[model samples]
Target: YRAFERKYRKNLKALYLVHPTNFIRLALQVFKPFVSAKFGRKVMYISDLSELNQHIRLDQLCIPNAVDEYDAQLLAKEKKPSAAASNAFQLNSTENGKALLETQQFGVSLAFIKENNGGEVIPPIMKTCLEYIS
Candidate 1:
C-alpha cells in the first residue's frame, strides 16, 4: 500500500475491498492511526459483487471463477439456519482436531479445508506442497 501510494497517489481513487470479514475490518482499525483520513475515506468496504457493481462495471474486470464460487458459498451460508452454521465454530476434539492443530501451509489451515470441503481428501498439489514443506 505504501509503495502504491508513493507511485500512484495522484491517480489513485477509491480502493474497494470485497468480502471483508471481521478480521480484515479489525486489522484496518488497528492500523487506523497510521493511515491518513484522506486515504481512509477513499477506502470502501463492499459486502459483495452486487454492491461493487453499483460503483464500477463488473464485466470490465477478469474475476476468477474461484471468487464467484466463494461468493456463492458465502451467500448460501448466510441463508442457512444459525444452528447449522454454528457447527463450523464448534470445538473439534476428534483425530481431525489434532491434525488440524498441526497442519498449516501457505496460510491455509487444514481445519478450514476439511470443514469446507466435507472431509474430502486434499488435492494432489496441496498434498505435494504440504509434503515438501513438512
Candidate 2:
C-alpha cells in the first residue's frame, strides 16, 4: 500500500471490515490489546449485515434485474473528454458555427451522470451554505 501510494502520490481511502459475529469473539480472545491500542475511538462495530448493506451498494453480488441491457450499454459507451479539449468546446452555437456543439452537449451530460452517480454533487440550494463556510 505504501509503495502504491508513493508511485501514485495520493492518499488512500478504504473500507475495512471483519465478520460482525466473529469479530467480537476474536477480538476478545486474541486481538483486544492490539485493536484497542491501534484504533481507539476510530473503530466502530456494527452487528447487522443489513445495516452495512444500507450504506454500501453490493451491486456485483446482487445485480438488479430492472437495469435493462440497452441502458447498461449506453452507460458503458459514455466517456470523459480529454482534459485539454474539455474546456475548449462551446456551449452555444449560431447557424454554420465551426464548433461541434452536439459533442460538447453530450460531454456535459456524461459529466453530470458520472458526477451525480459517484456522489460528487450537492443540491444548488445546499451549495450556497457550503460556499459561505469555505
* Best model number under lDDT: 1
Q: Pick the candidate with the highest TM-score.
A: 1
Which window of 10 residues has the lowest lDDT sum in candidate 2? 9-18
| Residue lDDT tens for model 1, 1-134 | 68785668766799999999999999999998999888888889998888889999999988899889888898887777587545644444234445334345433465556767756688556778899999
Model 1 lowest lDDT segment of ten: 93-102
Taken over the whole model, the C-alpha lDDT of each candidate is: 0.76, 0.47
Q: What is the per-residue lDDT of model 2 for residues 1-134, given as tens digits with 9 covering 90 to 100?
A: 22455544233233324234575656654855654343334345543344445756655455344434543554455556666565544333422445344654433444444556547565444577789999
Candidate 2 accuracy as TM-score:
0.24
Clashing pairs in 2: none
Model 1 RMSD vs true structure: 14.7
Clash count, predicted structure 1: 0
RMSD (CA, Å), each prediction? 14.7, 16.9
